[model samples]
Target: MPENMPGRINPEHITIVLNQPRYPENIGSGARAMRNMGFYNLIVVDPENFDLEKVEKLSTHAARDVVEKIQIFDNLQKALSPFNYVVGTTARLGGQRQVNSPSVMAEKLIPISKENNIAIVFGREDRGLSNEDIRLCHGLVNIPTADFSSLNLAQAVMVICYELFNAGTKKKHDFNPRLASCYELNGMYKDLKDVLIKISYINPENPDYWMNYIRKFFTRMNLRAREVGIIRGLIRQVNWYGQKMYKDGLDHKKNQEADL
Candidate 1:
């Protein structure tokens, strides 16, 4: 591992996350690809088959260290809780799935990685990340392919890891400040959603649909921890004022009935 230079990426800050992977072989190969690219942190969320022997066999000796250090979580949000920035990988794009190419994602990540922990999330083999999974991501990356868009899980992992490795060696000095971790951002979103619903700013029946636009808007800002706290505080104040006004209206209605 090289020292963290001004324009170089620190591989230690980057994590490879596999979400709901079906096969042990793909997990092993994904670890191997991370090792090839000088990345070591690997997290598996809700894997279907996690056979250690098979995983080690496919990963081989070269990546045994990576295999040994793999962290398994029952869900994606908990697995990604510690990361400050998350870039999701998906072949399908439309609706809110605005994606950047691997190289572009790599470029964007390099600067962010300097001051934040990053997770490059790859979804399942059959279907990529679900809409809910995509909501957790700060950004998205799509590997360009021919007409046959489907890629083997390991192959997709390797492609993304390769780009990050390649980008790390280049000299592009763009400084991005530290951003809030997924945990803090998710907390802020939860509170914001509740407040929005209380004010009828978003439809209570389907708040997530409206919240998606808010998510993108805030994601673009790359809010820091303090900024998130500030937003949450504002939300609390709004909630308080709304309740106070509602109480006052009820009191006025009761007094008018008494006068009658």
Candidate 2:
């Protein structure tokens, strides 16, 4: 709202990504947890356990907003595509990959959201996110536990949202609106992706090879709208340079042709 800012996306912009969640009750509980923690936007993708009407009942009073406004997507990436920043939530560490502990990641992101679109992703209630799914995120976050670590989807949402809420509130700056809008980041990604395609550096048939890691880095950084815009502008410049170089070469070739 202010000049070019997206108008407080932290409160209105946080979106929950539930990937292949298999329990209706967990979904409801997660929704309720989000509302209790002060986050409202919910996005469920390719869930295995879903009960349209039952979710509200399980949510009790906390999940009412989710029940009324829940949006469903066919895949996690599509759900994540629209977001500028994305973090993956998992219970199991799953191998030895570099990742930030849940609380640590929260500490990093709360301030970052002041400038970018943010999304927190929760895997299935049972198995958690696969190696690939975790790879898609900018950073990995999990609750500290003993040998076994498993968190209900709603419970996970609650913990993460609580951290974010607290982090935002304690800040010194005006928490009114610090980050970019959902649409701005979405458009920037689209523009950048198009540039990648133009350069033939990215295969449209398989964009994940690049988008995943990029998503993780940006999500972890919690970029601002202006930053995203700046990057998009840079991409445009690179593409223009590539075209100009191509045209100059063609002109030289034409001169040679005429001489022949």
On residues 1-260, what C-alpha lDDT tens digit does candidate 2 reach at each position? Answer: 34343222366767888888888888888888888877888889997867877787888865686778888988876777666567787665555555677567766765456555678888877778887777556667877776656666777788888877665333344442444444565666777778888888888888866866665566555566788789889988998998999999999999999999
Write down the TM-score of every candidate. Answer: 0.94, 0.69
Candidate lDDT (C-alpha), each? 0.91, 0.73
lDDT of 1 at 91: 87
Tens digit per residue, CA lDDT, model 1, 111-137? 788889999999999998988999999
What lDDT is obtained when candidate 1 is compared to the true structure?
A: 0.91
Scanning candidate 1 in windows of ten residues, the lowest lDDT window is 1-10
Q: Which candidate number would show the highest TM-score if scored against the true structure?
A: 1
Q: Every model's Cα RMSD, please?
A: 2.2, 5.7
Instruction: Count clashing residue pairs per candidate.
Output: 0, 7
TM-score computed on alpha carbons, candidate 2:
0.69
Residue 74 CA displacement from its true place in model 1, Å: 0.5
Off by over 4 Å in 2: 1-13, 81-84, 92-98, 112-117, 130-136, 165-222
